[model samples]
Target chain A: MPTVHATIIARGGGSTFHRKNTCRVLGTPIIAYAIQTCQQAGFIDHVFVWSEDEEIRSIARSLGAHALERPHSMVHYYSGFATQEEWAAQRGRQIEVIAGGPGDVNVAFNCNNFLLRPETLAAMHCQAREDEAVGGVIAVAAVEPGLCLKTRDGSLFPFWNDLSVPRAEHPPLYRRTGVAVTFRERFRNGRMALAPFVVSREEAFDLQHAEELPLAEFYLRKRLGLLDSDRPAAGEGC
Target chain B: MRVTASIIVLERDARDGVRWDARMGGMRLLEHAVARLKGLPLVDELAVLTDCDALCDALGNTLACAGVPVRRLCPTCTTERFDYLTCEESRIRQQLLALEQAGLAGDVHCFGSWRLPLLSTRSWERMYHALLEDRIAARIVPLTTEDPNLYTPLGGDVASGRLFGVWAHPGRDRQEAPQLYRPAEACVAHLGRIRYPQPLTKGVEIAMTEAVTVRTAEDMPLAHFLWARQQAGRACHDSQDGGAGVP
Candidate 1:
């Protein structure tokens, strides 16, 4: 089996619009949730947080994860200096520097999705170990745009163009959950052909908008079985 | 491990106004069940067991075109009986035994036709793997009540309604301290040793519904919402991959 190491990308949210990596969700920093998933996966030999923000890196370190400072040029979304290729190079360099010599498995984990399960990463590594020819495995959910609307030229029209159609008749659609991506050295020119690693519905929902924070809290409680179950419907039984 | 998935489609009174083979989104609930079974690489055989002629014919044609083999059976044990609940349970067991007799050996996963609309593959994986570890496992139905403080009531009183605390009983409390209830579906079993009916036997942990189901008329919105979520995911994937499904 190849050595496995997880690198959590904690940058990008430092922008004015999004929450920082140090933001807490359910008791732990959002970054720590990602770190915990990596730490729990028995297959992973090491875990590190790659971030440009010092506080983010400190939080990761405090959570018992190795911290690697990312280049500022790469995280500044407005700078436009770091092309996709350079970004990949920075990540690859970090991987090589932290573990050296292209480790067997490199998990590109984003700190935004704290709902990711450890079993997901473990499943990807198991698949990676079983088949060397496969390039990568990334989490994705099936989606179908059955009936939706869009506006153009000041008029609203069907987007998927299948309006008034039942969802079951809709085509098989899939979307990425943005939880994690696993790959080996085969990632070429900032691209890798990834096999879809399907995730559960709860794990598919990630944090983005401010309102989602409460929703995330609810789901977290639900997952932990801390949420109460006994409750009657409105207008039904007093 | 060998897996056999069975879709139960029985005829109900039209006056009841619930379609036994209703279409949600764009396909019939039965179609979702059959397609899900076909997608499972572990499932060796598929059976559409029902007394409903429409269900049998529709599946026969569907399976034929899909190049998948199917076994259709009409449940027997035509004995007359009173007490609707007992009859219902007995009939379900007979149908299961009938399906079992039709050569669907090994572990059997049963899904009510109405449930196929939104049960995701991951939920199936969870239940399947859970069954592998234990003798029996069920999929707990997660419900969202109109008010969080209210009891998570179900459409059919299929639940024993005798639960306390987490398993709230509708009869125990009327307007005060609304009881919380967790209604679960018998998702999987070792066919040889167990059979699933409306009220699960006993000692089964109630797992939150990993994949939502279309059980009542009230669930229509949730079904649409689930589709919307999937649509959103597809849009995200499209934007991320530049209009590609996956690389």
Candidate 2:
């Protein structure tokens, strides 16, 4: 069997932005919570977290996982693909790399996404296992581009080109959820897409902003069967 | 010739102290040691070593009144630098030196304050065997229990956790780490520590279990410790070498 390796990229330093949101998990650093989820899935052969924080490294070690130190230059929030690429290049031994694409697939997840479902994972693994052509599965939620907009260079543009309508009236378009990314070995060779496998949007959610984190947490708590109805949803904007 | 073993209870923080300044302890530590030593048929004679002046005086008075001899040794410190060997070595050396200065000639055994439960008749036999008959390169024995405060909070409540053990070797220097003994493929005996929040077993239990024994300072006789030092000296040959012998 091909060894499955994962890298959870998070600085794990005390974040001024999401202090309350980040402090809820235990046994590992905030980022490692995702790494632990991967470890629990049994699909991962080796799990590593790329972080510059010594405490995070210690946390990973304590969790029985390896830690790859992210260089100072690559750790800045704006410095994107280069960090993931360098991290994958330096430490991608035997396992594949799943690079930047969506927040749900990344390490710093919302608190609500904690009780991730195994079937969703099973569906992806099934695709990867049966179809050699598919690199892996990327969990995604259907979104209507017209319902979302992107602001760049002090201007607002439609999130996707084909959707001419304003985003407020329409439902949100498809967004990739980072719950898990099962990649193939070939994907690490600079290929754009993985051996594609698809799963339900209900199995995924976005956790980009601080407000979205608690929503993810709330949903995750429900998924894990830990909470009952009437619990307030996590992350305000969600 | 009388064989007296100085069991030094060094200060848990210093590196070294004057021969008389080494022995330091209170009534509790000595009482525990004496209780553990009661069953040692071969011990012949034993003394407690401590550095605290008040502590030493009180312990000395207590032990003398109890009919067990006590003496004061130099001050020594405790450290976790390498399994606490530095602290163990200093205490052992201080006690030995105190015995020598007091004009008490005997084969003295030195122990640390933390080594209370490890000093029993069964352990004495094993140490004697390792030194005299077994002729083993190195023998590390296990302690009956681990520090409940650090490793196991409930004190062995978890059934399948790592088996806790202490190391024991005759003539091995406490300064040297266990890595040095790896070359000999040393013999290690794993002994379980009695569960915490409960009293320690009355004596060492030799029933079989799986554990690794490394070397600790509490297992050597004064003569063996002296021999180890001499061997280290011989191996040094030249003072520049700074002997790293079996001790």
Tens-digit lDDT string for candidate 1 (B1-247): 5677666554632223455466655666666656655666667776665556765676567766775544555436222211111214564476455656756666555443445455555455555665555543322122211111212112312122111122222333222433223223325555544444543222122223223555566444445444444445556679887974311
Candidate 2 deviant stretches above 4 angstroms:
A13-22, A25-30, A77-84, A93-116, A144-173, A179-185, A188-192, A200-202, A229-238, B1-247
lDDT of all predictions: 0.53, 0.39
**Candidate 2 accuracy as lDDT:** 0.39
Q: What is the interface RMSD of each candidate, in Å?
A: 23.0, 33.9
Candidate 2's TM-score reads 0.36
Model 1 segments beyond 4 Å from truth? A12-16, A131-133, A147-149, A161-164, A188-191, A230-238, B1-247
Q: What is the DockQ of candidate 2?
A: 0.01
Per-residue lDDT over B161-247 for candidate 2, one digit per residue giving the tens place of the 0 to 100 score? 121222212233222322111011111211111111221111122311111111233221221222232334445565666653221
The global Cα lDDT (0 to 1) of model 1 is: 0.53
